[model samples]
Target: MTKIKTHLSLAVAISGLAATPAMAQDTWEGMDTNSVRGEVQQRYDAALAATQDPAYISANDPRYIWASEAKAQCGIALGYLKSRTRDEVSLSKCRMAYDRMMDVPRPRPVIAATPPPAPVCNRELPGLIFFEFDSATPGPDAAEIVSYVTENAGPCNWSSFQVVGHTDRSGSNAYNLELSQRRADAVANLMTSRGIPQSALDTTASGEESPRVPTADGVRELQNRRVEILVNN
Candidate 1:
């Protein structure tokens, strides 16, 4: 009986050892870490090449915006690994080499910064008029503006339009800025009430500083208290 028990234990141990290779194969079949590392290196090289030439940088700039965030993640992984395996002296040398490479700056591509196209007023006159002196409530003149927009503005092509409200130089700059943003929200709400989709409009505010007409410091210009519309063309 003792001999039989010992043989049974030996058999179970042998069976487990036999299954180990199959389990390892199953785990490694679909996931090749070395292959993934090679592919990541290829992408990093390509991104580095793009950053070299001005034209390529303009067409495919990885510094300003990532071509693939995954590739940048791979770079971070490589940097971390490099920092780990080396001795302290070697690690410091590697860091200095990386810093020197990064310090070499490249010139930006020469592209004309053209102004955006003018807003298509389309004879609609403006809509959603803003109020002056910390008031969001639209007055009687606002009705005319709303009517013109409803009657004449053509089919909305863009997904969103912006309503930017401004305030005259009156109160604290910060307070006026917040007030201006509220005014913009009020105008956007007005537009939503007139059968336009609320999802298609956004609001922003520029306080006393960004005035339509330049004024002396602390001058409360009524003309500066207005709202402008911008369409995503």
Candidate 2:
């Protein structure tokens, strides 16, 4: 696989400096067990009215699709509400719509795949390390990882490694990005203190914009907050 250079773009680098909290609630609502068809329809319409992006439309409106599916499922329950009631036909129709919509594939958000490991460095062995949340301090976990790089340094002909920090999609993009950069710098400092040459290390940060786990905003997935080391020989 081609070696990947791990570095955050300037936009991300700047954005990470300003960490902000996530919005408390999603604007779209009505996905409830007790929600009626009309309520679901209302929420869907509202969501559509709120968006101006063409790309948003091309990707089937998630709110409407979800509402439609909920209505269908509710129909099945409504059908069974009265075994001998007169609303059987209506209930069946609801179930049918739900089944059909469920069969339709919804558009999934696109995400970039993880890049391959960087080529071995010439002076220091190349390796990657992960850090805990909101902290630049390297815990015991990082020691073994650092050791691996040092052990293999000669054989791999590794010279230097770049530490890239990342955060989950929780706070404001700008803040998270800055935090990530700091985290990367912290890791780099640790390596240097442990006998790695200062010239053999570089650092960068990518705030919550680039996440390992594509969770919704403010979910705080640990996997998303981490650092990646890229070796350059």
Candidate 3:
């Protein structure tokens, strides 16, 4: 009698499994982790309804029992797998955001070295022309100095000339002033004769106000009685 009852139970379980829709088989494939979990739960519920056996072992088929046990283990493993995936995705996004916030070094501007400024001509004639005591006239050797200035003025790039006259303090201030003016005038005339333009020449008389060598009130200094020529561009 017990054997007959077991056979009847097996026959009834077989009929129920045969009636199960084909869509339930392999439904977990191509599903996301959540979808797979939901499918497994649905299958277990359906299997439970078909039989009274708690192990869901129907028709003596071990596949259903295996699937039931596998699903439980899969649920735990899927939870940890999903957690790791979420953390990895978040880490990737954070790294990208940090890179965007960082400053990218740009190419620096190439600075060309600046060439030195061209030399400007601000020079004086090579030598000073000295005069005799109380004399405004040029000595014989003074012609050579004048010639040197006139010859090199254009080549030296001199744009203008300044002729300054000086004298010793041996004479009265008024007489010295007049003598200095005469001396400047003489130099200016000589420059003009040598082809220096009158427009480019300037003349001044200092008398005994500024002397080359300091001396007593009535002292005569040969260096003080002189004319200076300056060139400027």
Candidate 4:
């Protein structure tokens, strides 16, 4: 239960910021009044299991860090839910943390055969890596996600990659565009350092134009602050 910085959730103090009904609903996914605690508890159980999972523990999987973080955040939310007054903000943070872990699977190391055939997989491999608001530098999960993308690229025989960056509508249009591009470059640069050719990457910045979860012009929706790595063979 180490205080791992849960990026977007804690990047800004939002005690005074009350989320609108629409925004909260979208952000919470299915954490409604009826089953909020039940749903969160389910993810908490899964996160707890991940911490001790040999697939992660034995091989030092990077995702284990996220799982551990999710467990802590979710645990906090569960505690708050038990109190007389529920903290909506904390619950939102917990849900977002759990969402990050939802798609990621346990690490499975591949052992190459002596004379294996050309690497290929009949499937698509895409990645969405979030960032702290207003910052171009990658966050804690950057390296881990980059590694995941690169590992899958080999099997997909990737011909090209789309590295598009986005930002929550918190700043001016002009400034946001620049920030988004910088974020794209940050992720693209990681790929280049990992040996993914620059020419093969098509980078673009959506700024506040394309948000995962739309909000007001000045809203700081954590889910909108992300870079999507789209892969194609």
* Residue-wise C-alpha lDDT for candidate 2, range 1-233, written one tens digit per residue: 12112212321332232212222132224343344444334433433232222332233324233333334223333433323222323333344334344454656645776344332332321344445556666544466556656655555666777788888777788888888988888788777777778889888777887775578988765556677777865
The CA lDDT at 8 in model 4 is 27
Candidate 4 to truth, TM: 0.55
Per-residue lDDT for 1-233 in model 1, tens only? 45334434533442233223332232223545564345445555554443333442233212322322222233433433333321222223223323333444555644887454322232221343546456766543455445545433454344457778888887789988888887788777767787667777778878887885577777755546767666654
Q: What lDDT does the true structure give each of the candidates?
A: 0.49, 0.51, 0.55, 0.66
Task: Write the number of the candidate with greater TM-score, choosing between 3 and 4.
Answer: 4
Q: Rank order by lDDT, top first?
A: 4, 3, 2, 1
Looking at model 3, which ten-residue stretch has the lowest summed lDDT?
85-94
Query: Would you give me the overall lDDT of model 4?
Result: 0.66
Model 1 misplacement above 4 A: 1-125, 128-130, 156-159
Give me the candidate number with maximum lDDT. Answer: 4
Give the per-residue lDDT digits (tens) of candidate 4, residues 81-151.
55523456556655655666665665555675434433322233255667766788876556866775776
List, residue by residue over 1-233, the lDDT tens digit for candidate 3: 45335544543442233212342244334666666445434543443332223223222333332332233223222333344322222222222222222222323433776444222121533335667778889754456556657766776677688888889899899999988888887887888898889998889899999996678879876657888887756
Candidate 2: deviation at residue 20, Å? 35
Best by TM-score: 4
